[model samples]
Target chain A: MAETYPKETSNTVNRYKHQDPSIPVPVVLPMIGQIGHYPSDQQPHCYLHGYVSSRLMNLAASPPGIPLCVAATKLDGFVLTLTPNTHNYNYRSAILHGHGTVVDDESEKLWAMQLVTNSVVPARYEHTRVPPDNAEMASTRILKFRIESASGKVREGGPEDERKDRRREDVLAEVWTGVIPMYERLEEPVGGPYNRVGEVPGHVRRFVDGENARRWTYAVEAARKAAPIKRVKREDEG
Target chain B: MAETYPKETSNTVNRYKHQDPSIPVPVVLPMIGQIGHYPSDQQPHCYLHGYVSSRLMNLAASPPGIPLCVAATKLDGFVLTLTPNTHNYNYRSAILHGHGTVVDDESEKLWAMQLVTNSVVPARYEHTRVPPDNAEMASTRILKFRIESASGKVREGGPEDERKDRRREDVLAEVWTGVIPMYERLEEPVGGPYNRVGEVPGHVRRFVDGENARRWTYAVEAARKAAPIKRVKREDEG
Candidate 1:
């Protein structure tokens, strides 16, 4: 079943909507690349996976009305050089900003807490006991910060900085420079219902195949490079 | 022969000097920690290691400098829950403000690039070939930004959101809530000066040992835990 809400436009980020009841504005779709997913309805509560450290929350809240916003930036690459000053890096990130509030209402609180868990790992809520009734859960202060706005920035490239060191090209230091691309995979659901049956679903099949395909392609490429006669090796190996 | 400068007490970070220009900045005694060294040598310079992106340099430059600066933050840990939104993460980063400059002086430019390299991998400068040339290095719009003011922030902790959470402690989904610490090592120095005959230097040895020790200690503990049972099994087999 699906319930449709108005798609987030530019306006939502500019203005605060659910301030009083303090409902945590859901996380905007994550910055997932080609195969990554903003998986739908993974848990009973339709919530996205995210959490802010209590300390950061408190620090970000120091400005009174202005909430602490977090922006996660990842350095994907480095542009190196002959001169010391020229080196730089390329990166990606998630920016989360808003005045978060503590989950208080029993029902909404239950959902928020459960959603935090399930959003991170689908169905984790089911594996454990319900949260609110427990004393440990009752004691910790989890505030629901109303997300105000956020944006993403990414960059990838080679030693574009070497232009100034024109003469240094032929002398290109032997420092290794290239992408050893990182792959992200959420392994087959372990210890959950799938583990008991010892069967993974078709949906999970893609995640597995994608990983293997990536590995196999790399392996084949390595073999081809190693072969004495490249084309001859290809035929012999095939 | 050795040249010694009078030790300045007031500004510890700025006073420390690199005794050897050949060693990577990180390996040079004074450059070890977060503190820096940029004393007034015959030619004055600054100890610049980590900071913001190149845009920072432009922010502080030329005609009517821009009042605003950009920031880059990173969230490293991914807290995957049953839900999608809570798949959070932990991380480390630097957000800086101010204008950076392009070093024009040949000597200054050379050392600046060296500092950046050492910042990335300690002792990387000596192991790696010397900086290329102006053209190759020029591609990196290396702007030297004088950090008039800046700060670094770090966060660490388990999912405390569970405090306000409703779930009980023991059964609290039994979700993994701890750090997956990040460790990195420089590949055993390959093609270096004395690459064939030399054993790793004491400094490099100390560096690897410090981090690798942490990693292997856990393995040793794990092996110990299973040793008795393994011994008994071997005897039975015999």
Candidate 2:
């Protein structure tokens, strides 16, 4: 889970606000996050950057912090089966159960900021204006999440049909069962209004080309693989 | 909110258990969901299909259902700025607060089933084997979400830098700030081992080509647009 989004830093974080003891509900926030092990830390944890609601900000300021579930899901392909009920997705999902606290240490905060910035585009922090001013540092708030437990699941390969459906020649003849490869693709860079640089930087170009190629290969390869014999029991299964 | 994800159906749902009043944390599950209004109903609601943990299933079975939050996020592009703190992503996120109950009404359940199947690939339910048998229907479970409220946010356009950074000639010249367009791309479909059909059907081909074009256009257009004058106040703002 710690290395799930080393490059792609988008994930949804779930925070529960227990306002009433009798009833509890979760608040979901789409956020940018990166997992890294600080030089001085014993293990890796997650650093989350987002403007949480004021209520959640207060929750993070308290002792022991707020309990959170950080999740990242990547869709590889859509598996088309003989029946709609059996259709599934080839995907990878990672979830971490943790407690989040607001990072106050200047050094750790700055390092985490660099880690997150680079996570977006490799070495992007150094490419931009260096060492944020006091005002910038003061304004930024990062949540340091200490993960207690984590789990990940990966499902890949072609579509799977039930034995009964496989035996029916009529259904097989009519229905088109297969996998549609899908992935996040980075298009050519579009320079900003203030950009004075003659050409897209080397770092930016590399990231765009490299990610597109890697993602395409992964999705197509997954589509070509054999389906798992014992598929995870979905809600549609009796 | 009801019209959100009318075509692409992927959302993460957060469910919390109040087993212990002293401690509460959210459980996040990546699931397939779609929003639709049945002809018999006055308003639209979300229908979710997934194999939830047994505990969550039990919770949903109880009266009033289980309180939940369903969220969908789409990243349009990466916005690069002169400073690391100002860097952001052009994206859209939607969240719905609701209670999820298992759909028991047979007719409604069947309708919701078709709704969710087509959400994956347009008109997919009818293309495959028709009318699930009693066993298939008995095994499948669809969660009907009664929407209490919902909200959404969209961010777009080029990089935004602070006044000081914009004034710095050296910083402006050095940093190649811009928007790198990003979007999910669907590649050519690959048939499964047991697929008897020779060519990718019209429905599957249309979905792949149509979606790729639509997503690509949206991302590039978003990158060329003007940034919001007063961006959402992020944690990095003092």
Candidate 3:
């Protein structure tokens, strides 16, 4: 889901570009039944979802399914202002509202499992063992979520201090204020004990390098107030 | 809050240790009024909070106050299994239930602002401009949340596949299964345009290097099933 905020608003303020999804965002899966009861006057139902094994799924499965929510966030930069009052962060976050249910269909469960595996490292499913055996399939449980609503929020750009602070010559002269760009960097992969492979596989290496560069470039450019360069020309473009 | 999951249950499983708060988790402040209304049948009082300007706070202030929730999560590693069916992730997450209100007291607001700034990078508050001026204070809005409830959930360690898969000699021989350690690395800090400082400050430099080393060591040791080396002996030790 994409959201737009007024230019003046503190949240949903995009700097480099509006509603860019290529930037990797952190994902969150809220826990179900973890938070105790909210007052009756407050919102009653909160949802959370996570993967489960068949053993655990059978134990928790009841008439009505479990509640679940999935969320992800991408931190852009740390906005450092001259004063603490104006400090802020640029970020993009999304939340998915859903309820968790067991994936009963064998093929669908396998597909979901593969999807999740590949999500950690692109195309990793093809590199590993193929279809799981019957016992493995029977023991594994996939929590298929039926999503109800989803929302995305974003905040970007340099610090937004008050006009008076910005005008203060003395403070501005002494105190340096700007964003310290921050992004996750994937380091050189360490091989496992039984990793028979001579070197890190091409796919794994490429994914690590590619993702690190993409995020680093985006954050540095955003801090410098540079817009992302479009690779393809659109028909509507003048 | 700490949750104990039944050995047979799945969602709240804690693998390595229980409720270790030193790990840096991603902090999230839910935005108010951004998420559309939840159906009363679901959860009635769903509260969220986001940072706002002092100007907006005055306009939005009302009795009974706004509800809010703060969340943080730390991703430990990606659990890679021989088969796709058993893939999982190691993580730690915390949530705080609270009500948001404006911090009207000047000193308290400054203190809270400093606390938050330093939280991003330890000792960072002292490095920047000191107490905010009146106009900066007037414009900045510190959301003093009255926390009512809090809870933490965690998952860690290697993949836990079906017993049959673990026992299968042929599967074990051919298929490699282990965790791909993952942790957030702070990249080289970028200086601001007007940053007159000759180099990255010692404290900031040390923090970046220290955090990277700490996380890297933890992930590597966990991947190898090695216990962390204790820097100091506990009081209980002879």
Candidate 4:
């Protein structure tokens, strides 16, 4: 039989539409089995994961779950305006609300560990050793959060100066107003002291270079208010 | 007459001694006046500032003030172990607990704005227009938080695998274990469409390059267990 999962509510979709889908956004859901039925009579809860040492886990374990908020921001550019007050930044940021709790299931822990590891560098799981040893597994901990709500906010394009500033001849002539694109870049990998491999592994190199290029292009295009070009057009085509 | 401020306890100093001083770590302190003396009737609080529209501020302003935890992580390296379970990351992460509120004072708001701007890029405040106009000032908002507690955690150097894995003769010969240093790099600045300037200003250029270099050096040195060289040593003296 095919497996089934809960569908996303329109509320959730509208809320996170502005967020970069590549980044993981925690959500709350009911636990269900492969047969598409609820695993038990228990109510739905938030399932989130983080490192064993995460402070979020510690806070959650204490008495009632800790009311927590997580915010991540990606700076696209520095927006310069003719007037200092009108200066702004082109950015994309998300806020998540949740209550943290530790996960004790071994299998669930392993799965979450793999999920997070691969999230940092895709395909990283297959390249390394399989299932962790008893001690290794014991050392790792998982945090399950109860997510309540989340939202994403974004500001893009050039500066938005006041009408007076834009219309003033002196201000318009003397000041340059626009955006200076900014994005994170990953440098070429440097081999470790004990690395016997002569070349940086293909996966590592690809992740570093690919992520940098993707982010750079996104920031520049967003600042310019240009839609991302997915394919190169042929010169002969209209 | 001399003014005095509350001093950091020895316990706090010992706890944060290992943290990199360059990064801002949030702290909870009593509300104080221009002389740095705690106001007689006011209680202790968390003081933080971000761009006017920061979600952090909005969340903090709601009702009883959200029980907020702020976390920041600086990835030093990716630790590759012989086994997947043993693989880890060398990093420094800090968590702060606080309750947020808005600061309505115009002078205080401007000061915080300048402080945050300079923190992003040194000397940036002086390079930009001096005091903000009335409309500009009115648009900006500052958040003051009531901080409860904070702590930082750091992991550095190479990977640590299980004893059995390390002792296995075959595994020792076939597997590589070490740290691949990672850091955030700032790329060359892209000028705005309306920028008439022929070249990027010296301060902006210096900030992008200098910050990148500093972070790169710090991550690599931490992974290698080497003390950072503060300045170039004379060849003759060495």
Best by lDDT: 2
**Tens digits of per-residue lDDT for model 3 on B1-238?**
1111111111232221232333211223344221122232232222222456343355327643443345566666666665665555556665444345565677756666666666567787787677766776776665654444444566655556556666766666655555667677666665554445556667677877898899887765556552211121111100
lDDT (Cα, tens digit) per residue for candidate 4, span A90-148: 77764433345665778766766666667666777766666677877877665554434
Ranking by lDDT: 2, 4, 3, 1
Output the number of the DockQ-best candidate. 2
Question: Least accurate stretch of 10 residues (summed lDDT) in model 1 chain B?
Answer: B229-238
Q: Decide which is better by lDDT, 2 or 4.
A: 2
Per-residue lDDT over A92-142 for candidate 3, one digit per residue giving the tens place of the 0 to 100 score: 765444345565777656666566666567887877677777776776665
Single out the weakest 10-residue window by summed lDDT for candidate 4 chain A. Answer: A29-38
lDDT of 4 by residue, B1-238 (tens): 0001111223322322343443212222111112111243155443444443343445446664534344455567777776766666677765434345677767667766666566556666666555777777776665565434444567776667666766676665555556667676655555554445556677777877888788888777766752221221111100
> Residue by residue across B1-238, what tens digits does model 2's lDDT show?
1111001111222122212334546667788999999888887889999875555667779877877778888898999899999999989877776678888899999999999999989989999997999999999989888876566678888888888999999998899989999999998999999999999999999999999999999999989876543233211100
lDDT of 1: 0.34
Q: Which of candidates 1 and 4 reaches a greater TM-score?
A: 4
Q: Classify candidate 2 by CAPRI docking class.
A: acceptable
Q: State each model's CA lDDT, in order.
A: 0.34, 0.79, 0.51, 0.52
In candidate 4 chain B, what residue range of length 10 has the lowest lDDT sum? B229-238
Look at candidate 3 and tell me the lDDT of residue A215: 85
The DockQ assigned to candidate 4 is 0.14
Poorest stretch of ten by lDDT in candidate 3 chain B: B1-10
Question: Model 1, residue B43: what's the lDDT?
Answer: 26
